[model samples]
Target: KTTNMPERPFDSENARKKQHAEQSNNELDENSPTNNNEQSGDEEDDDENQIKGNEEEDYQEDDDEETPDFTDDEYGSEFTDDYLCPELMAERPQEHESLNNVIIVDNLPKVDPAKLEKLKEVISKVYNKFGVCRNVYYPLDKDGKTKGYGFFEFQNEQMALEAVKQTDGYRLDKNHTFSVTLMSEFERLTQVPSEATDIGNLLSWLTEPDAVDQFAVQSDDPKKTMIYSNALSQPILLEERSKWTETDFVWSPKGTYLASFHEKGIALWGGKEFRQVQRFAHTGGVQHIDFSPCERYLVTTSARPGNSEAFIIWDVITGQKKRSFPVEQGSPYFK
Candidate 1:
């Protein structure tokens, strides 16, 4: 107190040392057992935030990869709007509804089911002679017996008729004979006749529409009188002129011309004349004669016992001899 001492200025080194010591003390406090719980809590909060961010990223990826459902009716409704319509779905049928162009043979002799395949082969060969490939339907009954009939569908009506005329009553395998006729669609028609009940409506319904219109029984006697309805005023009369066993006869394509043949030569008649147009000579008895489709030629066949078997082709307009083909010895006699 007696001596005057100089006043000590603030020492910066001491202040720095005090600050460093306080920071070290704070760090030690955080590492202490009591503060460990608070430190772990902060670390857990950080981890939770990181996990939440990862979960959000996963959810976005899934949304991008997902596919839309297409099987639902709403999807179909939208898809069809631009591409499909009712008209496109529905298709129109063809004008010609006939199943085939050829003839169908419905009558065949009943045979053993075991021999069905052989029977079909024989029938096919007979059809081929008329220049046609046929489709045959042979169905069997429960007892494995042939129902005594089959169906043959051909490619052309002319060919079919030719086959029917040729092979009808034809003998196959020495024992079996067949009766053939045109197949009828009466079974498929809704309307039926009363007499059709006898033959199960198949035959009655199947009467040819054009045939019914053209031909009618004017008299009850089928063999004696038939009044044919023609487009002209004068109806034709099919009279049995001669008793020489006349089986079939047809008028020429033109109503002006008529032809009837017998064991004698071809007898040509006309609308104007009861006399013959031309008495053409054939080798044997004439079996069949047909006018060519173009009306230019006439085809005539003759069946004799041994030597006079021949088919003659003639010029229709001039009645001149065109050519002749010799038939084989055992060839069938067909008209």
Candidate 2:
């Protein structure tokens, strides 16, 4: 029981060989070219796939960037229908000739060449307050003098309109007043009206076939005023109008005009159709009217409240008021 079996001798040489062999096999496995080649091939394949995937993603991004996005915010909803398809678009309309940006200033003071620049400076100073003046053109006479009128071009139509409205009838001096108008209106005003061609001679009524004297009558009904030829057998109606006269009517001394009284003033009617030939504007009501013996002048009397000038003398043919007289404390209303 006490005798120990001889301990197995440690096999140092055999153990060392086995361990060395195992370490060599392991190193060989790690350093083998075939195994390394397979591992590297797998890595290469993965890299190629990764690169291809990146290239495909870049191509997709390029395609997205190249495609046009026709959105409402960028091109508008009607761009395709109105601009792209030319046949679907309507033809552009022609623009009318307008002088909307040009103004005509008349009644300016005429100046010689020496003072022309000074006058222009003065005019520009006045209009520059309203808007920027693009150009100022004053026509020159043969003697190199500035005309009394000029053309002003403004930056826009609104400036021209404001200039015309504010400066029309503007008094620059005691003797000079501005007659401002749009160039467009100047063109229209220069052309005569179409009705001017249709106007017949004023003395056509004097040539009646029977030499019958024509007389106008105001009926009891306010609307029924009539003119008649004083025929020998019967009164022949010539023309009639409703509410022609307000209070009274008169005939010119030579029967050249049939005058009708109106609250504003008097209306002179003549010719074959008894058309209105002229009108006089008296602010207050006209109570009495008298024509000169020769029918060359008309005198109108009005009793205007708080107004001293109640008498107006008008040139009949020209329809221009020649003079006005103020009422005195004890003087008669009319002379």
Clash pairs, candidate 1, are 102-154, 102-156
lDDT of 2 by residue, 1-335 (tens): 59877755677778889999999999998789988998999999999999999999999999888556666476566556556767645654222223788889999999999999899889888899889888889999999988799999888889989999999999999989999998877766797654542447777866778888888888876567999889999999988888888888989888888888887899998878888888899877788788899999998888666556588899987788899886665433544
Worst 10 contiguous positions by lDDT, candidate 2: 89-98
User: What's the TM-score of each model vs. the native?
Assistant: 0.29, 0.45
Whole-model lDDT, model 1: 0.62
Q: List model 1 lDDT by residue over 7-98, tens digit each.
A: 45666678889999999999999899879988888899999999999999999999889587777668655555336665754553232223
* lDDT by candidate, in order shown: 0.62, 0.83
lDDT top scorer: 2
